[model samples]
Target: MRALAYFKKGDVHFTDSLPEPKLTSPKGLLISPSFTGMCGSDLHEITDGPIFMPKDGETNILSNESLPLAMGHEMSGYVKAVGPEVTKFKVGDRVVVEATISCVDKHRWPNAKNANTPMCDACKDGCENCCDYAGFSGLGVVSGGFSETMETIEHHVVKLPDFVPMDIAALIEPLSVAWHGARVAKFTEGKTALVLGSGPIGLAMTLVLKARGAKKIVVSEPASIRRELADKFHVETFDPSKHGERAIAELRSIPEGGNGFDFAFDCSGVAPTFNTGIAAIHYRGVYCNVAIWGKGINFNPMDMTLQEKNLTGSIGYTVEDFKQVVDAFEKKKIDPKECEHLITGRIKIEDGWEKGFLELINHKDTNIKILLTPNNHNELD
Candidate 1:
């Protein structure tokens, strides 16, 4: 097995002769990954830089890499094997790895708040995703989709219908992320939405809003390509560069002079976007934060109070989000060319650390999500 691994003290690199994972119980599936997208966090884990450095000497979401572990989480693959315990899935099925492993425990069900709180809200009664014991992958703590293969619990896999391409399946994880935000917003077909970024997450949000039947979708972005892509989707795009307008100003011009979005999803997690979300939401509207902004900033709670705006946060997705995304793709709603447009570059697994993952961190403005393919890894070669 040619697994892409972190060269402990050096840049990320791979080696030949990686060990194959033994088949576990019936609860697991062994998948041969077809495509894996390099993520922002993977680069963060490899660098000893700020933001997400390794802690406890062995665990940074990227560096704690369970060394030499394979990486790549946003991916799609074919099930090569299934444990006897698995019931719904079978070998040769194309699926997207959901990338979270969890089990139930009481005192932590239906949390709906605080994902890292070491308790499952759903697990207390047999529901997971909010389980008291939530185990997530691509955390740099667990083996990832970067390698040629992954042994994931059956529940973590979402089977894609035949109509969806394998390449598009790689996007399921991130699409789920956007779906979760929409879920938090409690979107209905006729509601208005504004996605505050043109990045991959932001673009996904735009896609989701359209599929969910948003009456009017506004995507605010400065990048030319992203703005164009949003336009291609028939979304009303707000380009910040040309107008120098804040998000609030853009929405105000829509018709109602700042009546605001029914559901505002902040994808940039930037201070400006936050302020805009607060200022532009209608009364009783929901503002959901899905972007991970690390610092706290000054904002008037009075604004939220006066408008009756509901403030909420969504972490990652439940398995249900993944399912909804696959179904969206199966319905021919997810355009393959549009999905591939989100990809800016592709690199071999061997170059992932130094060249691939590294580029994701330093050159974000130039790329959306860089993908790493085992198509060039030595084991397969």
Candidate 2:
């Protein structure tokens, strides 16, 4: 099987010599990927990595995976084969796999109150996403969605609605990330929000905010194209370069009596955005950090101290998040048709390096998401 993989920290390319994936556990399922998204993290891994992709020699104790790792986590595909133990799904089922690797036994939450089998302490607390050593399936684990075929445990698979297009189903992964962030921050109906950045994650955050009935949504983005894209979602946009510290002033004044946003999500992963996002929240408000930053920023304790604000960070999504996103899509809360704008380009696997990865690296300000058709050549309508 052909796969785009990370050979070293800064080296990643498509290779035809990659072997076809096999199930490591009887609980696993094989998927022939239809559409796999080129995530910003994948670009980070290819450019300045070894961050989450695991270094050449080191193995992730949880996933037990090392390097030359296949890249890609956001995708949707059909179940071509299933292990004998996989009873939840069978062959020919359209599904989106949640990429998180939990420490608990399968069949825990969203069904039974608890697992009859023992689980990790974090998993026991219903925080498998925060388990001590949870690793993402695609990043540091086995072959990921970027390959022609990949295998994942059935516990991570979520069945997609028949009405959802395969290309749109590919977005379920990132949408779940945004959904999880919103869930973490306790975003509720009638609340207001300020999202920092208009990249894919930020845009997805805005859409999720809207779906949850956020009264006012404001996005601060420097890029004109991204700002315009946010505007299409009916949210106000601010150019941080122009507004500077006054960006928060605009966000606060949007709501009556200048109460400020109930939640602020920083998806830009930039030092400056971190300061602005924290300052934009209302007193006692929640600030969710959704970006994967390279280094720590100098955070003023008074920012959260005086205001009594709550600060939190979000990483990968849980199975519950994936289920919520699929439910939203099925209920028309998130329209797949409108999300087509997020796909700036779609390329074949062989062209992934130039069209998928480099296009994002060179023109990230203009592109939102790029889909790579690893196994199929059909153009998304």
Candidate 3:
């Protein structure tokens, strides 16, 4: 089967020599992936990793995988085969793969099935996203969505509606990420929000907020194309570059009364954006960190304390988050027309670097959600 594999930092290659995956567990299913979306984390992995992608000779405690890893986690596929004990899914079931792997008991079955297996206090508390040993399936597990196929535990697959196209279905994973942050911040209808960036995750947050009935959404970004993309969704946009020293003040003015936003999300993961998000929220408002930060930084806790504001961090999504996103689409809260706009373009696995990753990295402002299909290429819609 053809697959995209990592050779070293900044190098991902296409290969047809990798062996086809076989169902190894009674709880596993073989997925013939139709579409996969590249994620920001994937970019980080290819560029500077060995971060999440395991090194040679070192096994991941959860998936037991090492280097030469398969990439691409945001994916949609159809079931080609299933293990003997798998009852919920059968041949030809369309589904999306959730990349998070939990439970990971090293002493027992290190790479054992962890779908419904809660091995941590967080998972035990119904917060699997907070699971201590949570590892991504694509980054370090068996293989990823970049391949022609993936062998995933039944617990990690969610059935997709027939009405949902595979192209759009591939977005479930990333959308679930934003959905989880909204859920964590307890976002309510008619509330206002400030998004720190207009990248894919930030844009997804706007869509989730709008579908959830946010009264006013303000997306702060410097990139004109990104801001324009957010504007197409009717979201009010602010360019921090335009405001300069008064960017926070300008952001505060977007919501009613110039007081502050009801909720703020930092999706850029930069220090300035983090500070801006913290400063832009109303007193007692919730601040959520949606991006994966490059490095930890020092911030004054007094800023959080004086306003009695809530600062929380959200990582991967839970099974429930994916379910809610699917439900959002089904209920028509998220318009398919609008969601489709998020998919800027598509490329073949062979062109993953030039057309997909490099294009995104260099011209990120003009692109979003570029899907990589194993079979063929897809031009911008």
For all predicted structures, in order, the TM-scores are 0.85, 0.92, 0.93
- Please write out the lDDT profile of model 3 over residues 1-381, one tens digit for every residue: 888887667878888887777776788888988889998888888777877777767766665556777788898888889988888999988888888766632222434433344468886787766877766767765578888888888878899877788899888888899999999999999999999898899989999999899999999999888898899889888989998899988787778888999999888999999899989998999999999988988899999899999999888898888889999999989876788889988788888888888898998788889998975422311
lDDT string, candidate 1, 1-381, tens digits? 877865453456787766776554457778888778876556656664322223335543221233455666787878889888789889988788887555421112223233245444575553455554454554443456778777777767888777666766787888888998888778888888878887878888888888788888888887876687667677888876676655466675673545677888999888888888777778888889988775888988888999788998887777789998888776766766677777777777777776776676777776777777775432321
Highest-TM-score candidate: 3
Once all C-alphas are superposed, what RMSD does model 2 give against the true structure?
4.2
Identify the superior model by lDDT, candidate 1 or candidate 2.
2
> Whose lDDT is greatest here?
3
- Candidate that beats the other on TM-score, 1 or 2, i.e. the better one: 2
- Candidate 2 lDDT for residue 373: 87
Which runs in model 3 stand beyond 4 Å of their true positions? 104-118, 376-381
2 versus 3: better lDDT goes to: 3
Ranking by lDDT: 3, 2, 1
All models, RMSD in angstroms: 5.1, 4.2, 2.9
